[model samples]
Target: MAQTAGVKPMAIAGRVASERERCIGMTDAERAWRKQWLKDQVLASNEPVHVEEYWRERTNPIRRIYRKPLDVLFTTLAPVLGQQRAADYRYITGKLGLIAVGVLAVHYYFKYQGNDWTKKGGWRMTRTKPMVLPGQPGFPYKSERCKDSDYADRGFSKSVFGSK
Candidate 1:
């Protein structure tokens, strides 16, 4: 590799180091082999390949990026908690746990005796009815239902309801 005429030695070395880091210590031969193998695999693959495939068109990147943080967290906690238990702990204490707490809160909110401003004084019961929203069309809340909704809306609703 010929260095530029005016480039400093340190700068050249840094550039070489950066390039080396890109290949993770693999030699020129090894990098060429890997590239050739990838080309062969792509050519041999039955399915057509898209060069500009998106995050939607490819899932591996999405999966890896999303799980990286959780993986680090679980590994960090695994020694103290045990691997299986660490994973379980993350599952139980993460979003799922928040969901459990939310459900419990809703349940207690509705079912608890004299909660929700009915018992403003906090310990005593009152027969106050649940407040109604302005848009509610009365007891059954007669509202227009959609026969067909947009795909994007459906996806948004799905994620909101906790499906991956």
Candidate 2:
């Protein structure tokens, strides 16, 4: 190839030569860490077409937020469960864990959907749009806004307005 300084990256052909040499020089721990890190990055960067990406996208924010926790749980439990001998945790927590999450997500969706009396302006869940009026649902302020937009009145769009 066109390798220079014996270290500079070249096209696929020349780069592989240098990389193989470098890889052979690493310690066992370094090689293992590099390998595991690459796998983690791949899982984290699940492409749009991957099944994992499909569920993650369709799931709501509440369920989606638990991916890491489930990952940790499955990873930690896999070894204890005797299904996986490796420390990577993919054995017990990868697809099966995601499937469990999917089940929980569906359960949550229906559970709340059925009991959504609060959708009628009970607490934080409101189906109807907020009205834009004083002391209304979505009004900015109960009082008045400052003229300067720097002081503090009630609500003048921004708190920058000065209040009398």
Candidate 3:
């Protein structure tokens, strides 16, 4: 391949190394066969063929990403925890763990974080006692019903507390 005018040598070498790494596991014969197959596919197709699309079409996308991590987890735990226990742990953590974490996060947010406004200056409970209306049994000592004199003077009248 012809080198571009200002590109560094290391950058070119890194690109070639990355391309080879994509085919790392194949034997030389298998690599050659795949190369020939890809070339034939490109030649045969009327539309442009993408390498990523070719791989994704043949493999299960979910299995491809999940298989490696789950295998490592199970293998590491199997010897120490026993096979059945390890399998159960994997099932709980893989499926239920995420759901539990999400629920706890939502609960915490609503109970604490979501009430930030109440902490700043919003409505709040007070230590002061509730007001008692005039002429009620506790009016003289406990009532803070009004600051006006007419309400205080009218206290204990026959009209308020029905005649005995």
Task: Give candidate 1 regions above 4 Å deviation.
Answer: 1-59, 97-164
Name the top lDDT candidate. Answer: 3
lDDT of 1 by residue, 40-151 (tens): 6555455565465574565677776866777788889899989679988777766775699899987776566433322444343334455567777575444343544532
TM-score of 2: 0.22
lDDT of each: 0.60, 0.55, 0.61
Model 3 lDDT, residue 32, Cα: 71
lDDT tens per residue, model 2, 11-85? 542222357665668667666766775565553344435487778788888865766676566657776766445
**Per-residue lDDT for 76 in model 2?**
73
Candidate 1 positional error at 125, Å: 26
Better candidate number, 2 or 3, judged by lDDT: 3
Which residue pairs show collisions in model 2? 148-161, 149-160, 149-161, 149-162, 150-160, 150-161, 150-162, 151-161, 151-162
Best-to-worst order by lDDT is: 3, 1, 2
Compute the lDDT for candidate 2. Answer: 0.55
